[model samples]
Target: MEPTLPMPAAPSSIHFHANCTPTNYSTSPPNSWPPFPLAPAREISSYLNHSRHLSKSKPLPSLASSSQPRTLCFVAMEKKFVEEAGCCYYGGDVDVDGEGRATALRPAALSRPHTQAFHLAWLSLFACFFAAFAAPPILPALRPALVLSPSDSSAAAVASLAATLVGRLAMGPACDILGPRRASGAASLACALALALAAVFASSPRGFLALRFAAGLSLANFVANQHWMSRIFAPSAVGLANAVAAGWANVGSAAAQVVMPVAYDAVALRLGVPVTVAWRVTYLLPCALLVTTGLAVLAFPYDDLEGNRSAAAAAGGGNRSNTLWAVVRGGVGDYRAWVLGLTYGYCYGVELIMENVAAEFFGRRFRLPMEAAGAAAACFGAMNAAARPAGGVASDEVARRFGMRGRLWALWAVQTAGAALCVLVGRMGAAESPSLAATMAAMVACAAFVQAASGLTFGIVPFVSKRSLGVVSGMTASGGALGAIVTNRLFFSGSRYTVEEAISCTGITSLICTLPVALIYFPRQGGMFCGPSATVDDDDNDDGDVGANDDYMLLK
Candidate 1:
């Protein structure tokens, strides 16, 4: 007789076959059957009891079948969980995984390639300013060597600045069409070639002036530098990044003031070279540096205006014939861009004018030696290393605290203070016994505020229109140059107005410019003219509504 075995427990979700046949199972009840040979019925009953106890404890699924709906529901739930945990559904490309979130919130240190791009952009801008201001620092040497009278030298200096202004105006459209990498590289190369030619073959003052003017085109690299930084850094950090680039580059002018004279003296004394030849040779180093920087820009992979490796790659048609024209039109149509340009003109333009005239002002006012005055004047440009970056950092903090209003508020505060400082400096200069220390202090304060204002103005530039950033940057920079030119004409005009009067005039102009800045409005947070009605598409969407926000957002 067969032993009576206990039943084993099983999950309801699983089904098992109960057929008993020679090919399938033994001819006995499933719970009672034992495929393996048992010594006696007692052993089979004991085995069945142990199996039933184990099944009751675990209730494991049978090796038979599973529900299709349950399996598919589980799969769908797992997929949904993954997407919720790992995906960004708001059009951002950032992954939402643990590591991805960490990376997005606090990015890793700049990689080598990014670092290289930053350094190259900085060096290129520095070289441009270095070459542009090279002639000014050595103007004393050039005066006699090139047989330039005081008026002639001053006019030539202003001409170089004027040329830079024109270059900046054109650079906007060029940067948009050709892209910053190519535009920067080409401008740098042209500057180097011009400097080299001037150093080697410029015989007369006029010839040298012409070459220097040509070399001043390098100043257009300012636009390229800012554009590069805008692309490389996050929107929140772009203010500081642009300020650092601008500030470091502006240091080139001060460096030239200090280094060029020393280099000339070193070459003349150590090499026993003639003064004329030594002065000319002094340009070779900066020229070589400029050329090398240009080549580096060409070699490196960088983004164009549209954030592409190349302009052709960015555009499907591969034809940028109308790009320049469209950029200009778009830039001009945006009143906010022009207002910012005007604001920049007051701050940066004042800096440019003061940079060129500070030495003369100090020399004439304090009756100091040329060398001492030059050193004192250098203090203005040198302050850039600290002041410019500080401005940018401060602007970022203000934005964080106050949102869009904080940016404009910061701009207004600094410009107003700057205007006051300028007036104070003028008042001190006009006093009977002018205090050189006091005036220098005032000038330094004024420079800091002015440069800070420049940083603040640009902090809002990228928000104006992503597609027209290059054009906007170029136009605002050109405004600085134009301001300088107008100020220079007033200050340097045939001994008509004194330095104090000119300084006062600049202060008055800057104070007035702050009004427009205060009046400017934004439609959305972190956006100037970029609202739903004014959305700009990358594919040349030129509907009448493209810049419609500009009209309503300018003063609301």
Candidate 2:
């Protein structure tokens, strides 16, 4: 037989409902019973024992038959404030919300979709970077084979940057239409085709210039790379995700510098192939790498956490051209985007110049062999492995303490310091200069500062306008190309300035560009060294209705 316990008498017309919970009970009147909140089993048992004793001491009369029964129900309160408290190994370090987007960067956990997207994004970009810059390391052999003049070489460099500028601008809207996965993969494949053709047809100055221009379309992958990270990670972690992905991808340029010359020697010397034919054969390797990585990127899933992208596109009027126009129009209208673009031009622009000219400069200035010069330049690109991510980490840490204003201050400070270091690099590069060892040390320091500044620039990008992230990224990225073009035309291409003089001018331009950071402001979080304005609408603030004390939540 079932054991029976002493029961409290119910009030007249009262009925208990089995489907009730604590949430409704807490909000109900005194007569309603409750669903227990989640707690330890022992604590619940103790409370039940006390309730049983109270019922025995204070029994009530039974319900009357003539009165209608009233139903009472309740539910346990939903926990709205659960914090992330899990390990990265088990995928807990990243806070995955209901929709599966991560709130923290857990790069070591690549088995998960978010982290997998991060890997694919960077790897594809790495292939593109390698293929795009591979020509420079072999330029010594290449220039002689093509019988190119210095003017032709510089014009080729400018052409590459110009093509990349246009490509980046177009890629932003393409990402909005097709998703980052498809956009990036397509770009890689297209540029691989260009690279392969360059191997076969780059016999004349015009052909080399055209092929270089076409190959530069590869760098447009940068837009997809940053946009992908921003969408997969939460606002709190987006900056670091962007930095780490791009930083690691940037290492491809360094790898190209080291690998291409070695490959050339192996093909030309060890294999007994003609030097010209060997360089052409070496080009095939990067093309193959690009093709493989691009297809791999396409094989991965598109992490569109929201419903179907096609559905979203349909909802936006089912016209891709209109959507593209709207996205670019809205993105360009933001003054902050323009400011960021100019700033990006100087820092990233200077970095581009270094990647192109570093090997050549070292070879020409110090009379080093091709292998030795390439090694020195590789060090600059290698810093992207840690220095860029360090900048993002610094930005995140400062924003946690001082809000958005803190991030801007950190960006300005580092960029200014980096520009000053660029001037120092010029001083060290004099006609009768210090030892190569000392010059290399200074170059490494300047590279770290410049790359870190690039990282810091993107740290502020996600917060600019979440709705137009791709376009804004494109604008900023294209700015780097434009800055390279102008700098190359004025300082690098002609006989106007020596390489050292050009570098100093580049540094000064970067310093002036850093001034625009003062114009970038978040309504609730304010600008650098300023409080929130009283009259501006904060529609762009993703962390809604944040209090002074709650700014940390946004950073987290």
Candidate 3:
């Protein structure tokens, strides 16, 4: 006497199979189908509507026994089907196209999370770069007030790089644990506070150096910035997106070089404020901007649109801490990561060294005024605007034709050319009668190549290991700091060499570092001169634990 529910026939495409066989079909009474428990009414309606659309005239077969088992089986199959075919966000499955990423980038589409994440990532790093480099442009004023010697200035640069190195190492694992959104935002806010303290309390050389070290922690945001882009964008567009974000952020350093000096001039000269007080006040601009953008990063976008780590418990059924340690170990153990780190050291490390010393170099060697020297230095960092993006775009373009090998070739070619240019610029400085115009011209070209090399270096980073993406990013970024520390300590610190001599030595080191690019090879993707293995396994997931739900999300 159990009442049965009438159901339309299932389409040929819908298959319902399970382990349990029905006990009785002919003996089952009419009007006796069991209702599916916990299935929402709207979902059942949707399924019926879909069934009706597939077949209008076919009469549906009755259930054997109005049993709960059969009803549950149908619901399970439906849930699985929706998960595979339907696009989802947050904890659900990602969009299906590019593995949870959009195929194209739309910078102007601020309403979308994909685009919003991109803007927040770059802007946060941009603010951090500004704060970290702000002091270099106004070093003339700072040195006089704080009684800092040339050695102390060099030590300050070393201190900052060392702090940044530690921070980068820690942030990589933190990004994997807490997500890039929290990791980057917290670092930015902390560095902003340090900048504020430096502006107010840094009256002596030691205090200035300590605060500079603290502020340098902001640069650790670079690891998260790259990690965020890699997670959000598809492999096809990831290179350009990473390059564009980092390149735009780097312009902040150039902006600091120019803006701080101009702001100092406006306050000290026009307003008749003391030079010391004007420089102190100038620090507030970057400090406030850092706080603003840091909060924006935390507030706006989803932690990761694909939620790769959201279901950490289910991936291999391992504990979260064990997984984290595994990823760190995997990233650290990889020889290729070390090679990329060394190569990154020369390109990005040289860029950092330039940001700290270029203004001083121009002022002392060329006899330019403070503002003019800062402006010239700004030119070097400014090349990042286009030069870096060109490197990334070139990597993506060549990659389409040549796979991973093409990316390696592009990086080697561009980086080698950049190293040669660095040597040329140093020789120009060593000229008996250095022509300012000609030197500036050569420096501009050198900047273009050097910045492009940075872009090209990252172009290969993402492919190294998807599972330890953040850790690899951190290792690579920290290497840049280590390179700066070594190069600065050896050539520039304690008046070990003339500025021109240091520049030449640094260029030579860069050339030596570029040789390692040949050693990096991917098993499935091939290498600089090798082809992929003939029996390649497409299901290889050796790098990291990518969630099944972490697929592409196409933006409308």
Candidate 4:
């Protein structure tokens, strides 16, 4: 006879069904049985019969036996019974089955407010990006209307990007200090006001530049968008969630490229308006959209790290400046954050440059018609709809498979491929009979890889420092703007180097950046930088009394 094992206490979090049926059992004598607190005698008999069948040739081992074979047999039987019964034995935290098969865990349904908050965050970003990039599509109309020189027009084109860099630098800390909801609404309102002013009285080139620079502040909305998504989604799903929010918002730039021309034509043809009037009026559509999104953000419920309003208020109320400084100091001090930021600068920075230059580059390199070159250039922007999200999905898959290391690996792999594609594009540009089709294909491929790299870079941003997610995201985003500035200077600086040489330089720079990315080491259990020490108080309270009170409240 087998010794009776003591019944293990059931975890309170698990719910066992009262109507659970026992497995069919043959009429065989059992040796030993483990005690189950709630299981009926017939259920115990069924488990014993199953275990006996599993150990067919070898007799059942006594539970008290010191033999290795007997211990292995006992564990195997217990595991088998657990699997057959479909009981979750590892509390409710684990998502694996008893047989060691990985089970997909379904996320809890989101509350209505949470759902609305998420949609609002993305829509706000979309409106901001739409307004910020609106200048590029309307540049042609503006050039003739404002009597802008080529240099003035060039400056106008990059005004938003330059302004966005400053905005991101400022707004990152703002989002951390103020909640995402408030920050997003404020940014939208500012952008809408800038656009409205430009539409009503933007007669001079200088006026247009000033208005665009101010409107470019809307780009800061990206930081808030990521912060809000991080608060809403779990770490496992945050990558994809961030990707979706960013990817869709990014589509606004492409939408502007498409919509601006159509809107420009529609106003002129339908209303018999002059080309200048049509161009100025088209800005109103995005302006109205921006105002609506801003109001939505203001009206919607705000989400915080803890997803509790009282907790968020308590955390955000006092020491707001201290919290902002702490977040900035921590983000800046981390070497991994800097490396990621520079890497992002290369991928996304180059993307910004390409957006403005692609049409010109294709037009000059292949001797294509202006319209054809513009169409080819537009292809790169259009790929954002699918490519950016794909990068996030890939990062999630790699992280799921290999943890933190896998995320970095995915970023490096995509960036490396993107660099190679960049070189291919440059070489194609110099070919004797460069096929427009071939050049466009390489350009699209390059865009996809770069945008995907941007997605992967952000995939690690929120993980670097949860408390400083806004700062980290902002710094990384600013890297893209810096990269665009550098690349644009290289291409347009009127040096002896040809455009192909400049293009190849970007690829080479990207390759050099990949080395540092490989060296970044994230802890297995703690935050990205050091270990547990890297994790600071999420709510920055310098006072010990308040910290204690917050801890007590959280526990309660």
Report backbone clashes per prediction. 0, 6, 14, 2
Tens-digit per-residue lDDT, 123-212, candidate 4? 788888777666665565677888887667567657867888888888777777676778879888887887788778878888788767
lDDT of each: 0.67, 0.74, 0.75, 0.65
User: Which lDDT tens digits does candidate 3 get at residues 294-388?
Assistant: 99987753655433342232233465544777778868988989998998899889888888888988998899999999999999999998998
Higher lDDT: candidate 1 or 2?
2
Q: Pick the candidate with the highest lDDT.
A: 3
Candidate 1 lDDT, tens digit per residue, 1-556? 2322223442222123323121211122334433321122122223333343343344333224332211100000011111121121111222121111101211233332334556788888898888887777677677777788877777777788788888888887777677788889988998898878878887777867776786678898999888777655555667777888888889988887777777877887888898778888998878977998999998875452122333222322344533555556767778888888888888998888788878778888999766677788888888888888888888777877766677788888898899888878888999999999999999999999999888888777866755567788888888888877787787656778777888888888889887788556654543333333354333433332223322211211
lDDT of 2 at 94: 42
Worst 10 residues of 1 by lDDT: 69-78
> lDDT score, residue 509, model 2?
88
Superposition error at 217 for model 3 (Å): 0.9
Q: Which structure among the candidates has the greatest TM-score? A: 3
Q: Name the runs in model 1 displaced over 4 angstroms.
A: 1-112, 304-322, 526-556
Q: Cα lDDT of model 3 overall?
A: 0.75
Q: Which runs of model 4 end up more than 4 angstroms from their true locations?
A: 1-111, 305-322, 362-374, 495-500, 525-556
Candidate 1: count the clashes: 0
What TM-score quantifies how close candidate 2 is to the native fold?
0.80
